[model samples]
Structures are given as C-alpha cells and as structure tokens.
Target: MRFSLLLMVCALCSVSQAALTFILGAHENVCFGVFTDQPRTSISYYFAVQSGGAFDVDYTIKNPRGEVIVTEDKQRQGDFIINADIAGEYELCFSNSMSTYAEKVIDFEIKVENDKNDFKANMPDQPNAKPKAHIENMGKTVDKIDQKLDELLRAIQYYKTRNNRNQATVKSTESRIYYFSIFEVLLMVGMAGLQITVVQLFFKGSRKQLV
Candidate 1:
C-alpha cells in the first residue's frame, strides 16, 4: 500500500505548463479549465490584455466545488499563485460584457508545480544508506535556480506587455495630433478669407456714398 501511494504521488508530480492567446468580443465571456488530482498542489497564472476596450477585462477563478477563489473587474494584467486544497477541475474565466464595441486580445499562462521531489526528501532513510546532506544541498540549489528562471520569465512577459501598450498609446496620440493640426490650419484659413471679404465690402459701400 505504501509503495502504491508513493507511485501515485510521483505520478502527480508531472508538471503542466501552457500559454494561451484569445480574442474576447464585446459583451462576451470565455472560460478555460485545469485539472489536478492531489490536494495542496501549487498553481500559478499570469495574464495581460494586449489590446481592446480600455485594455481591461473581468476575471474569475473557481475551485473544484465551484467556489470562487478569486474575482476581479477592470483588470489589465495580473499574476497569481494559489494552492488547491480540493483536487478536481478548476475553472478560469474572462468576461468582456461591460464593453459594447471594443474587442480584447488576451495573453495568459498557467503552470502547476509537482511536489514529488519534496516528498522523497522527507521520507525516512533506510539502514546503511549514505548521508543525504550533499544530495539535499544539491536539490536546494536546483530549486533556487528553477525559481530564478521563473522570475526571469515573468519579468520578460511583463516588459513585453508594457511595450505593446506603450506602442498602442503612442499611435493613438499621434493620430489625434495629426487630425487636430489639420483642423486648426483649416480654421485659420477660413477666418482669414472671411475677414478679407468683409473689408472689401466696407470699402465698396464707402466709395458709393462718396459718389
């Protein structure tokens, strides 16, 4: 029985990672799923709005029992980590129902961490077994490296999202500025023509009165 339990735990340690991009239309909502078989499993997610209405969307996460774990409105980007105490299918949803005309571009990722290594490290040592101090130290080092890599990846994604938003803003501003400048020039020319016409009419009337 113990061996079977260990095997099950090891099987659960297989990590899953996925990145998704989707379009949410006006007044629409979308949902996705992730499944786990063990309690207290680590789940991480990150999401950003690449474009669309107000660059924001509403999001919700639910556990296996359909209990809401997290919900937010008008969020442009987010990162979250949670431990699932109940093993089953988890739901993630995004809503754009508040928007009337603008569609949204969304980029998101989900990652699950398996705990088999930690479980093995905590098991009792057998008789005549070698000291595990060096092995434990090596495992710790590897964990640290993995954590650093995850952080780096998150940072890169954040910067990319920020760059996309900045470019969109710049383009929108440039378009408005161009249109405003053209309108200003046309207004000035129209006023100058009106003023010249008025002056010419006044001189003509004065000449007629003098005659």
Candidate 2:
C-alpha cells in the first residue's frame, strides 16, 4: 500500500518538473530556458538561496518575446506561477554578481503543466448519467488530492533548505569561536611572559644599585 501511494505521488508530481541545487560563483550569472510548444500552459518557478553572503540573489523571468515578465533584486526566495500565453521559449535567470568573493548555494524548481488539456482529456463525455457523475466526482477528488500532495512536497523542500542553511551557519559559528578562543589564550600567555621578564629586569637593576 505504501509503495502504491508513493508511486501515485511521483506520477502526480513529475509533470515536467525540474529540481536542482547548485552553487553560483561570485560575479556569475546563469539562465535556464524552458520551451513550451503549447499555449496557455501553467509554469511554476521557485527558488531559494540556501546559503552565502546575504542569502539573496537577483533573478528575472522573461517571456518568449524578450519581454520581462518578472524581476527581482537581492531576493532570498520566491515562488511564482505564470501563464504562458505565447508558446515558445521562456528564460529564468539568476545572478550572483552582487557578491565579489562569496559563492551562493541555490535551490530551485520549475514545473510546467498543461492544466487545461490534462483535465479535459481525463473528463470525457459519458452516455450514462450515473457513470458520468461518478467519473466527474472521482476526477475532482483526484485533483484535490494532487494539489494537497504538491503543497506537502513544497513544504518538505522548504524545511530541507532551511535545515541545510542553519546547519551551515552553526558550523561556521563554531569554527569562529574555536579560533577566537585559541587566539585569546595565546595573547594571555604572551602578556604573562612579558610581565615576568619586566619584573626580573627591575629586580636586577635594584640589586645593582644596592651593591
């Protein structure tokens, strides 16, 4: 039963979906192009800067006509769904040019679904009213379930990203603290040695003067 449910989830979620995690070097910009031959398709794009510098990046989305559909500057994460009214290639871009030395880890996903066609194909004309109603009801139920599953999947991704970022931060902090403590200890030891040397010199000079 669990295996079947997992399969169902995969089938529902695998509609032209791309999930990726990659490092964007400083002063580098990358763009991904998605081609859709059919018009009126739904496109879902999501991105998050997992770690680095300010945990932000510049991003832009453009239509096939070379027109900007959406653009953002120094953003940490975003989730957007836009309709592709014109059938062609769409571009999604990410830029890390703001950071000169730090590299950013980004997690993103893009999904394209022909929502209208899929629904219409699934629901066909039935001569028997009872069967038609039953089929329609089943389709609705399936759609609802699919939507809930998608939401759950997105939530899981979000938490996973957050966990990775937090872990990185904790490790960085630990390293800094460890090095700082060592430096502090060495400074204290050096100060003590200098004081001892000065005291010995003062005593020697006083003895010489007494003699």
TM-score top scorer = 1
Instruction: Give me the displacement of residue 47 in model 2, in angstroms.
Output: 1.8
Error of 2 at 66 (Å): 1.5
Compared with the true structure, model 2 gives a TM-score of 0.82
Evaluate candidate 2 by giving its C-alpha RMSD to the native, one decimal: 6.8
lDDT of 2 by residue, 128-161 (tens): 5567667678878987998999899889878987
lDDT, each prediction? 0.82, 0.80
Model 1 root-mean-square deviation = 6.2
Clashes of each: 0, 0
Q: In lDDT terms, which candidate is top?
A: 1
Tens digits of lDDT, candidate 1, 1-211? 0001011223535567888788889988888777777776787889999998579999999887999999999999989998877877777888999999999999988887666566766678789876788767887898899889999998898888899899999999999999999999999999999999999999999999999
